[model samples]
Each structure stands twice: as structure tokens, then as C-alpha cells.
Target: MFIEYIAQAPKEHQKYLKKMYQLLKEELPEATEKFSYGMPTFYWKKNVVHFADNTKHLGFYPTPTVITAFKENLTKYKFSKGAVQFPYSEPFDETLIREMVRFRKTELEELQ
Candidate 1:
């Protein structure tokens, strides 16, 4: 049931989701892709990042460290306490997404 919904979003959302998946794969080559809680999640050498799309916007679930680090850069966007809510009309920030991936990777590596 969850997998079906992730696979059956609208066309526009599908495009965005594809873009995000590709970008995450490129940025975090070591990460593995998984469908969890109806969202596309990336698991690196350890857990890294996750994201999902809604009818209105995309939800980026970076760790608290990521949110704190990018708090200043995210000022322009509509972010909740932790997640970054990117509307469909606006383009996704690939650079920032890459940065978060890199940051999480580094954190996980250090912990290990």
C-alpha cells in the first residue's frame, strides 16, 4: 500500500521525486535507496537523509545538525522547525541538498 502511493504520485511530483532521487544518488554515492514510511529515504554507511512529496510541496528530512547548519541559508525558504518545505512552483536547491547530504555523510563517518 505504501509502495503503491510512492510510485503513483502525479506527473509533476514524479518528476521532482525522480530529480531528488538522482541528485541524492549522485551526491551520496555510498547511500542506499529505500522506500520507508511512504517516503524515499537514503541510507548511507549509516542512515543519512529522507524526503517525501505532498500535493503542495516536497518535504526534506535532514538531521537536526543539518537544519542548524543551514538555518541561515534556509531563511529564504519556508521551513518548519526541522523539515524544509519546498513548494512545487519553486525550483529545488540542488546545491543545498548536496550540502546536506555531504554534511550527513561526514557526520556518520566521524561517528564510525
Candidate 2:
């Protein structure tokens, strides 16, 4: 489903979406993946995050808890209660993305 989703997305967006997928995959090697809300999502004990390609930005959904915790570090981008929009213009911030994923992973790990 994830491969099909990416394949059907616009040509220009595929690269960014693929990068997001790889980053998340690397960070959560143990996670199970599937399509959720029509977007690629990763889950461990529960849904950890989802990322999608938008017209002008890459949407990173790190759940509300992860987003709130990293709000300070994400001032430059647009973020809501549950997601962050990293603009296509700005260089992709891999480090920040990894930190957010790790934080969510830790939170989920501690829950059990």
C-alpha cells in the first residue's frame, strides 16, 4: 500500500516522500508499517507517526505529544497540534526529524 501510495503521488513529490519514508524506517527499524488515513504510517505499540507529501511541503505527523514536546525546536516551520509542515524550500532537517522519532519511540516504549 505504501509503495502504491508513493507511486501514485505526483512525480516531483516522490523524492521528498521517499526520503521521509527512509528516515522513519531507519529510526524505527522494529516498527510495522501500513497505510493510515491514506498516508504511510509506522506503528510499534501504537501509531508512532505518519508522513505525506503535500503541494508545497512535506507533512510530518509525529502525534500530538511529540509535536508539543518539540514545538520550541520547530518554530521556523508550520506546526499544528499533531503535525509539522516542512517547506520544500528549506533544506530537510534530518537531525530534528530523527530526534522527534526517537522521542516518540521512547514515549511508546515507556508506556509498556
Candidate 3:
């Protein structure tokens, strides 16, 4: 999925392409990576995250914990049960993603 998306993505999104891939892998070192429907998804005993660059936006596979933790900050963005739609024409919020990665990591650890 990741490789396919990488190949299909527009040249401008290449910068974010690498960054997003790196962050996901770094955040979930033990995650099993695979492609599904041309999307890159990571699984760590369960689904951790999935992402793809759409024609107009970059989408993050939404997790409830992420939505709850960043509700206030993400109010302006479009979201659904498990999807956050971020515009691809601009920069993504790296800080928020980093925080989410940390928060999810801890949450999963606690469950164990």
C-alpha cells in the first residue's frame, strides 16, 4: 500500500510522504506493515494507523483516543469515525501527530 501510494502521489507531496512514513514506523517499531487498498497501514497487535494521500487531502486513519485527546485542537478539521481529512496543499501538524503517537503508545502499553 505504501509503495503504491508513494508511486501514485504527486511530486509536491513527496516531502510529507517520507515524513509521515518515518513517523508511523518510528512510533510503532514493532508494527506489522502492509498495504490495503493502496493505503499504508500499520498493525501492532491491532490496527494502529493507516494513511493515504487523496486527490485533495491527506487522510489519517482515525483512532478514538486521538479524537478524544485532540478534540479541541481538531475541531476545525473534517473528521469521521476513523478518518481525519487534512488538506494536502499545506503543511500537516507534526506536533499533533507526535503527541498522538506518544499518547497511543502509552495507552496501548497500559492495556497490556
Candidate 4:
């Protein structure tokens, strides 16, 4: 289902989506991955992140509070509610992605 989700995206966006998936998977080694809400979702205690390839940007869902915590660094990007949009024209910041996932993992661990 994960592979199918990526494969079904636009060819130009496939690389970005694949890269996002790989980054999250590598960062959260113990997390479980699955197709949830029709996108690739990485779950620790709950859904940690969900990413999708959009028309001209990659959508990152790390929850609203997480997005707000990183808002200062994400000023150049577009965001709303629980989603952040990183345009395909701009390089995806893997470091930011890694940080968000690590933060999510920690947050979840503390809750349990």
C-alpha cells in the first residue's frame, strides 16, 4: 500500500515522496509504517507523521503543535492547521524532517 501510494503520485513528485518516506523510516527505526488516510503514515504510539505529494509541493503532517514549534524555521514555507507545504521548487530540508520525527517520537514516548 505504501509503495502503491508513492507510485500513484506524479512521476516528478515520486522522488520527493520516496525521500520523505526513507527519512522518516530511518529516523524512527522502531516505528510502524502503513497506508493511513490514503497517505504514507509513520506511527509510533500514534500517527507521528504523514506525507503526500501535492500539485506543486510536498505536504508534511506532523500535527499543528509540532508545526507551531517549528514555525520560526518554517516561515519560508506555507502551512495551515496540521499541515506544512514544502514546494517542490525548493529543496526539501531533510534535517528539519528528521528533527520533527525525532521530536514526535520523544513526545509520544513521554505520553506513555
Worst 10 residues of 2 by lDDT: 1-10
Instruction: Give the Cα-based TM-score of candidate 4 against the true structure.
Output: 0.93
lDDT of 1 at 52: 86
| 1 or 2, greater by TM-score | 2
Candidate 4: tens digits of C-alpha lDDT, residues 19-80: 88888878988889887887788887899899988899999999987887788878878988
C-alpha RMSD of each candidate structure in angstroms: 2.4, 1.1, 1.9, 1.1
Best by lDDT: 2
Candidate that beats the other on TM-score, 3 or 4, i.e. the better one: 4
Model 3 C-alpha lDDT per residue in residues 1-112, reported as the tens digit of each score:
4666686789877667778888888878898888765578887756777788777878887478777777777776788766788787778898888787777767777777
Q: Give lDDT: candidate 3, residue 31.
A: 84
Alpha-carbon TM-score of each model against the true structure: 0.87, 0.94, 0.84, 0.93
Model 4 poorest 10 in a row by lDDT: 97-106
User: Candidate 1 has which clashing residue pairs, if any?
Assistant: none
Per-residue lDDT value at 7 in model 2: 87
What lDDT does the true structure give each of the candidates?
Answer: 0.79, 0.89, 0.77, 0.85
Q: Where in model 3 is the C-alpha error above 4 Å?
A: none
Superior candidate under lDDT, 2 versus 3: 2
Candidate 1 lDDT score at position 27 = 85
